[model samples]
Each structure stands twice: as structure tokens, then as C-alpha cells.
Target chain A: MKPTPTPDFDKNHPDRAAANLATHAHALFAIASEHIDSDTLRRLRAARSDALSAPRRRNLLPVLVPAGALAAAVLALAVVWHPLHAPSTAPATAGTGAMLVSADSSEVDMAQNLDFYDWLATQPQPASAASAQ
Target chain B: MNLAAVPQHSEGLVAARAPELPVTLETFLAQVQRRAFRVAEMGLGNVDDALDAVQDAMLRLHQHYRQHPAQEWSPLFWGILRRRITDLQRRRKVRSIVVGWLGSVGDDGEGGPVWEPADPLADPAREIAGRAAYADLARAVRALPRRQREAFMLRVLEGLDVADTARAMGCSDGSVKTHLSRAMEALRHKLEDWK
Candidate 1:
């Protein structure tokens, strides 16, 4: 017949078991520490430094950086494209006429352009009058 | 001076004015390198990986010592070494995120941890015997699962308390407890068999 496991070695005995194990475990660690040498330690430090620094030591920024910059540039262009390319709010016909009026502000030029101004002044009255009545 | 000469002179000036730091980088390595290596070896099983991990941690320590206080180096070294070991465990496929999560959720709350402080100098004979026992324990510890081994070495061998071990291992106190408990169980079974 197979031997039945002892119930006495249950949770209650964990403390005693742990203590005994620790005692032996501690001894094992000391012996291992003794086998280790200064040179081995020095070598480990060197290897650790190399491994930790591997992620940062690089020269790929030039190749990788431009792609990110191009993406950002594209995104920026997309955001501003609509605002920049949208047509002006001014009445399309008024823009060229206003540019012409502003270009020559001399008394003689204004006197010559009085008809254009008069026509512009007359254009807005119809919209305002329609709104009022 | 010519533009080239001016640039050269500035470089020379910066080099001349550089701090004669009390702890030279090489000297610092010489000071803490071995202990750090031993800590790494004990914390992470597999001497080869431990060596690599310790070297990596030492390099980081050397690279950053100027930014940190000298006294804080030990804990910082441990913190970094633990990170390296975790990375190694990940690469070796010995530990999975699922296992770590399960271990964390299973910790028993004893209101405090079970590992206690014992006097090292008070009992020389006992200390010697304990040291021998620790050697065997270290091998058993190395055989444990990565998380359990980490918790065991950090809390027990490195003499770090639970909170410190938790910080080093990047896990909860509960997780540390669970790992430690499992580690203790494995050690007991293995040691009993060996004796």
C-alpha cells in the first residue's frame, strides 16, 4: 500500500518548516558568495553597463527622425490646408474693385474713381433696404 | 583667433574646467562592482545572465552616479539590476506576465512579511554554519521560478526588507509575499531532500 501523506505537515507547520529551510538556505548563499571573485564581479559590471546602455547607444536618429518629421509636417499641413486654401469671405467682385480703389488714393485718382465708389455705396443700400422692409 | 582655433580653444577650456569628481568612474566600479555582481547573481539565477545583468547595472550606475548621491548607489544598483534580471527572464521565456499577475494576486496578508532580521556578528559559529547553509539555499533559490527567486534573494540574501524588495522587483508587497512563500516551500522540500 502507498504511504498516506501526513496531515501533521499541514499549514500549521509552515513556520517551523520555513525556519528550518531558511537556516540551510542561508548557508548555501554564503558558500556561493565565497566562490565569486573580484574579477568576475568586475566583468559582470562591465557586461551590465553594456546591456543597459544598448538601447540608448545608437546612430539611427538621422534615418528614423526624418520619417517622424515628415509625418508631423503632413499632419500640420492637413490642419492648416483648409484655412489657407479657403476662398476669401469678401464678395468676390468687391475684392478686385477694392484693390483698385486702394491702389490709387491720390485726389485726382479718387476723383476719377468716384463713379466706382458711388456704385459700391449704392450696392449695399439694396440689401439693407430689403432687410428693413 | 581663427574660427577653427576659437572652437578648439572652447573645447579645451571645457575639458580643463570639468569637475575633478571625488569618485572617478573607474574607481567607483572597483569599489562597488563585486558586491553588485554578487547581488545580481543571487537575485537572478544563472551566473552568465547575472554577470551580464550586473555589468549592465554597473554601466548605468557609472553613467548616472553624478546625478545620484553616492549613498543611494546600493539601492539604485539593486533597482537597476532587478530590472535587467526581469528583462532577462522575459527574453529567456522563463517568466510570463500571466504568471507574475497570478503570483501577485495570491499573496497572503500577515499584516507584515515573514522574513526577519537576524544578527550576523553575534553568533560567529552559528553565522558560519548559516553561511554554509546559505550556499545550498542559493542553489535551491536559483532553481525557483524567476519571481520567487527574485523575491527570495532581494528580501533574504540582499537583506532588503519587504518594501525595498517590492520596489526593486516592481511588484506589490503582496506579490513579494506570495513569491517568497512559494520560494520558501520549494527550498524546504529541496533542502530536506539534500540533507
Candidate 2:
């Protein structure tokens, strides 16, 4: 319910110019408020009280915020770790994987290039290494 | 400041230490709530909606900004309540638009508005007339456009200074003055007999 602006309230605002309609408007609003029935005011007050107490019923900012942050952090960790901390692949690359599985570190001759191996295969069996060492 | 940078405000909003609000807060709310409801009703034209707006504003002030200095509460609460009233007005406008579109249109358009003067019996050349003059005044206030009505209520009725009203309205000081002036003119023309 609206209240009629009381004479005291109007008088209290001495700073306001007397010529303005604020005083009259205040007075009118005060009258309007006075006309409101009691039951309506009670309902409004009840609503206000309920709102004041709503945080206890469900304050999302407390629990939901931390929970949401934790969930997001877990999601981000999954994304980062999936790429960086994954288990070492069996062989990593196609060529490396095939050769590494079939061969060993000792079998992989360091100086033996694949191009040299092809050229040697094309030659006449290296001429028995020139008939002697 | 970007609000996302700090989540601590949530603590202030949710866990409002009742002690933080000064003793004036309760008295201030109790005193202002009725007038706020009336002002809201003038803007909304619906008692139920006006009640909700006032209650919401009270809760908002109590929960979020009650910790602010008591002196600043009037303008702050009025500003917040004004915004709430405008929000409801916008929602009602949207609903009305939808309904108007669905419903059939008429050429006379409800046969125009009725702007009758205040009931003569309610007035007798006093500093203030009885209930009828006030009723006429309220009717005229309601007849003004949304901005004009808000300006009248906030700047004049609420006694908020131009700057405070502007802050509440989220407008420039110049705009507030303009609205107030226009509202005064409109109200004076309609409510000339009251004066």
C-alpha cells in the first residue's frame, strides 16, 4: 500500500524548492497509500520477508559456483593432459613403428643408409669386395 | 570493473550479514516501502505487480547493497526500484504487443481515453483537496508517458535531485531535467484545478 507523503516528511525536505510539484505529488502518493487495504500490505510484507530468507532455502552462488569451477577445472585438466601426458605410443610413427617392431637398436646399422643399400643391391654383389679385403 | 574478475561479491550478496546494515535500514525500508508500492502501482497500473516490484526492490536492497552507506540508500533504492518498475512495464508492453497482434483491431480503438477532471465534491479551494483531487492527480500522472511518469515520480514526488534521478534512471542529468520539465507541464495542464 502506498502512503500519503506526511507533512513532516515534506517539511523535512527544506532543501527542495517550495514551488515544485514534488510536495503536492508526495501528498497525493501519501493519500493513495492510505487508501490501500490492510490485507494487501500484509501480503507484500510477507513477500519481502520471504525474499530476505530465500538465501537459506537455496543460495546457488555458494555451492553451485565452487562446484561449477571444480567441474570446469576437471574438464580443462582432461583436455590438457589428454594431449601432453598420454602413454607413449607403441612406436609413435608409421615408418618408425614398422621398423622398430621388426628390428632392434643393435640391428639398426648406424652408417647404413637406405639409398646406399639400394645402390649396393643394383651393383654386382660388390665384386666379392674386390676379390679380397 | 568486469564482474567476472571477482566472485567475492557473491558472498556479500548471499551471506548478507544482517548486522552490516545499519539500524536505519529497517526503518528506512518500512517507511519507504509503502510509497514505493504506490509509485510502482502508478507506473504498472496493477496492484499485484506493484507489490512484487516493491518487494523485489526491498529484497534486492537488503541482500545486495544494504552494506552501502545509509545516506545513499534512498537514491540507490529508488534507482533500483525504478528500474524494476520499468522492467515490468517492458514485459507488459511485450505481452500487450503479442495480445494485440493476436486479437482483432478496431477503428475507434476503444473509443479513446477518458480524461475527466477531479471530482468537484472532493475539492473546495484548500491547500490540498480531499481524496478526489488526489485521485485525479494520480490519474493524470498515470496518463503521462512512461518516461514522463517516471521523471515526475522520481524527480518530483520522490524528491530525488536531478543527478540522483538520472543515476537511478541510467540517463544523463540533462535528460532527467528535460523529462521533469515535460512531466511538470503535462501534469500542470491536466491537474490545473488542483493547484
Candidate 3:
């Protein structure tokens, strides 16, 4: 298909002088574009060949470097934050006072005291202690 | 049909249909390189910088949009070139300022393209007159605001339509018209004495 015609200053319009000037200037530009020096032409040819032969993917190192660094920084922050803010899983044990105990140790202690608690339950409490309780 | 005959017939068909196919990247680049250079030269007013800009634009188009449809190449290529020219212009301005502050002489000379007559026996008087006229036109164009110059060159010299010129300029079609109108008015006044 033919391309759309470029809009030009109308010859029959009031600005005939401008139309004429555009026409003249276009012709001159055509000439100038064609009459490039041999050296410049050679350079242009080399440039074209280089462009065509070169890889399609641009060197994204500049962009990728910063992007990669940002991603790494975010990952580091996440790693640090998870440990600092994650909920504690250790079992809460009453009567342990201010001492912190691991879940396994707390469970073991409860098992060892089971027999003693059972024996104590079988014995009756003193009257004064019962009244205080 | 014999196998040889089949192959030959298909080859003939392919050859016949070649012209109807979309333009390849190399062909597109070859077609626009010169005119692109000229436009760059006009914008930057330096030969080496213009050539660099054209080369950079060609590389960018090849790298980024080589796989696009052929019909999209013109606008894409011109748009890339226009941006490259603007970039070079900005760099030159910054360099000039820095050089001035350092008390160093900057190379702001216009190393324009060398023009030669196509016909060796062409009339010297006519050739000289044409050259003078072209020089004047180039000067006037360079003096225009960046947008106006871009609009004038793309729309007038390169013969790109309003839509393509708008795409190339990264602006609205209405803005292209306004800039072109102002450019023409300015050029007419500037070249009033030219016959």
C-alpha cells in the first residue's frame, strides 16, 4: 500500500511563498543527504554492518547490577527480620520463675514430677492449709 | 512432476515473491542511515557527533526492535535517532559549560558534510548557488527551536506523515502541526531574500 502523503504547505493557499520555500528546501536537503563525503559514508557503512552483526540484546549490566543489588538487600532484610520478629515456639511453663526453658526440658520435668504429684494428692492436706487455700 | 522440477518451481516462486515480502532489518537500516545522518548533522551541527549519534541509534534499534514488524521500523528507527540526537545535544551543552568553567577551548566547530556535484561537468555557477542556498537553509533550520526543527525536518525533508512524525517526535499530532507551522513561518522570513 502507498504510504500517506506528507502534509505540505498548500500551493494555492495564501502562503504560496512558504510552500515554494518548503519545496526548495526539500530539494536542497535531498541533495545534501546524498552528497556525503566518502569517509563519512565508509563510517556509516561500517556502523551499519556492526549494528547488524552485533547481538540483539543490549548490555544490561548497568541496570542489572543495581537491580541485583537491590534484590539481595531485600533478601538480607527478610532473613534478619524473620529471626527478630518470628513468634517464639518454646513452651511456657509456670513455676519456672524467670529462667527460660526449652520445650523438651519442660516436658521432661513434667514427666518426672508426675509420680510425686500423684502420691501427694493421695495424702490429705492439713486443716489450716485447706482453710487458707 | 519430477523432484528437480518441483524444487525449481518453488525456487522460482520464492524469487518472484521476494519483493512483496517485508523489508529486512539490514535493508531498512541501509535505507535510512544516510538521511538519518543528515538529520543528526543538522541537529548537532558537528559531523563526528552526528555520525556517532546515527551509529548509536542504529545499534539501539537493532538491539531492541529488530524483531518488530517491518512497517514499524520507520517510526521506531526515526524515534530512536531523534532521541539520540537530543541526548548528544544535551551532552555537548554540558561539556561546553564544563570546558568554559575550566578555561579550556571547546570544539564547537561545524564540520559539515562535504558536498560534491553528481555530474563532473555540471555548471559551476549553479552548483555554487545551490550550495549557498543549502547552507543558508541549514543555518536557519539549526537556529529553530529543537521541536520546530525536528518537526520541519521529519515532516518536510524526510516526507514522513503527521502520524509518523508525531511518533518520531514522541508528541501529539496537533503539536507536530503547530511546530511545523511555526517552522515554516520562521523559515520563510529567514529566507525571504532567496529567489
Candidate 4:
């Protein structure tokens, strides 16, 4: 294509020069765009077809993200709360003396021996007992 | 304000509310693809990259905004193309930087492949001149700041109105005018010899 003739504009006039430039540049660009090689045009056509046929990205991220975050928070809370509030297998020592019931027989014997000691203390010492000690 | 009392304004509101005539997405893409490719080419300075950017823009528009009003497709498509071009340009910049740092000779950093126009003119001399002119213009355009290049291409070459150009560039109308003015001034100086 013949390049568009540069318009007759005063070279010193900025406005006219700009107008001529816009016109000339636009013409050139239009020619270039319209006369794209057949190979490139074919590629462009194929690209368009591919774009149309390509599956739309099902952006589930927007919906899934918040839900996933929420689920994670709930799971973490469950994890934390379970250990804190779970029923204990060990005996409760807060209000009941039931803990002593589960103790070894030796501990029970020790408790019984405490009563014998108390009785021994209560027995007043005789004058003979005192001299023998 | 009693909206019903303003008949003209009410009519305009009703018109605005009226559903736009349906234009198929395929038709819209076809209509803008060539011009979009040109715009991308101008911005990217490489034909293949330009084509890639255009295709990417088309796919994104189809994927995300197919349900939008047809009247809005022009700005939306152009906006997508503009962003895609920016991304490609940025990638090229980073690649050039990496290539330079690595001391690789593969990329000369001298503006990747040049586009050779397929001129069918019987007069070889005229064809050469035409190609030279186009090359000169493209070079000057590529030299522009990113915003100015976008404004010039969208406003002048692609012939988008100020509003649509602003939308495509993600700027205000006044900003578009400012960018376009600066671009023109720059081009005027660079292309003075052509005039």
C-alpha cells in the first residue's frame, strides 16, 4: 500500500503537525491491522476458536475460600475444646472422698494404725509403767 | 425530588432500565479482535506476544464477563487486553533482566523480534517505504511511557472515545485527556521529521 501522502500543514504549526500525524499514523496502523498475513490471521482465528471452546474457569475459589477457612476454624476450636472439657478417666478429687476408696490396702492399714496410736496416747501411764520406761 | 414529575428524565431512566439488545459473545469478540490485536502489538512490540495477549484477554472476558451487558463488552474487552499487555511487557522486562544478570547472549535486550508486514504491493519501493513509515511510528509509540502509549493507541489508533479509553486504561476521563495530550506532545517531537 502506498503510504498516505503527508498532508500540507505548516511544519511549524504544532496543531496542524499533530493533526497530520494522527491522521497518517492512524492510516498506517489501520492498514497494518487490516493486512495481517494469512498465517497470522489463521492463528488468530484458531485462537478465537480455542478461547470460545475453552471451559469457563468455574471460580469456586471465592465461595470455597471462606467456607474452607470457616471449616478450619471450627475444626481447630473442636480440637482445642475437646482436651479441655473431655471426661477424665482418673477419679474426681474435688468434692468426694471416693479417691481414698480406690487407694491400696496398705494405705487403709496405715489409717487403722492411726486409731491404735490415739488409744495408746489416751491410756494414762501407771506408776509401775512409768518406772519400767 | 419527585422523580415522576420529570417526564424527560423518567423516560431516560426507563430507557436505561430497558434490556439491551442481545449481542452474542462470539460476535463481540470477532468485532474487536483485529483492532485489539493491533493495540496489543503496539504496546508489546512483538507480534506473537501481542497475539497471545489478545487471546488471553478474549478468554478472560468470555470466562468472567459473558453475562455482562453487550454495550459494556467494548470497555471490558479493552480493559482485559490492556492488562494482559501490561503483564506480557512486565514478564519480558523480568526475563530481560534475568538474562542480563546471567550473562546470556540469547536475548540481546534490544526489543525482541520485529514484525515484518506482508505488503502485497506490486511496487516494491512503495512497499518498503510503507513498512519503514510503520516501523518508525511503531518505534516512537513503543518509546512512550506505558500510560501515554495506552492512551494514544486507545484514543487515536483504536478510536475509542475518552470515556471508553478511560475505562480501558482504568483512569478518569481527565487523566485520559492528560495522558493523551502528553503522548501527542511527545509524538509530535519524535515524529517532527515525518511531518
Q: After TM-score superposition, what is the CA distance of residue A38 in candidate 2 from its true location, in Å? A: 0.8
Candidate 2 interface RMSD value = 15.1
How close is every model to the real structure, measured as TM-score? 0.48, 0.59, 0.65, 0.64
Model 2 residue runs over 4 Å out of place are: A1-20, A56-133, B1-24, B105-129
lDDT of 4 at B66: 86
lDDT (0 to 1) per candidate: 0.57, 0.64, 0.72, 0.72
Which digits, one per residue and each the tens of the lDDT, describe model 1 over residues B1-195? 011211122221211222233354455555445555555655554556667777777667656553666545656667888888778766655444544555567676333322222222122123232444444455566678888887777665555556767877788877877788777767768777543
| lDDT for each residue of candidate 2 in A5-106, tens digit (9 for 90 to 100) | 322223344423323244555645555555556776798678767756655333468988899999999999999888686657633555665676678666
lDDT of 3 by residue, B33-109 (tens): 88898788878777777789889898988998888888788888889999998997787777666655555443553
Candidate 1 vs 3: which has more DockQ: 3
Ranking by lDDT: 3, 4, 2, 1
Candidate 4 Cα misplacement greater than 4 A, ranges: A1-14, A61-133, B1-22, B104-129
lDDT of 2 at B154: 81
TM-score of chain A of each: 0.28, 0.39, 0.41, 0.48
Q: What DockQ results for candidate 1?
A: 0.10
| lDDT (Cα, tens digit) per residue for candidate 4, span A1-133 | 3323322222344467666566566666665666666777788888899999999888798999999999999999999998888677533533235645776888767654777979988998889989998
**lDDT tens readout by residue for model 1, A52-89:** 45544434679889999999999999998966776676
Residue A104 in candidate 3, Cα distance off native in Å: 28
Better of 1 and 3 by lDDT: 3
> Model 2: per-residue lDDT, tens digit, B1-195?
111212232222211213233466676787677778778777776767788899888888877776778867777899889889889888777776765654546565663323222232232113333455555666788889888788778866666666778888889877777776677667767865544
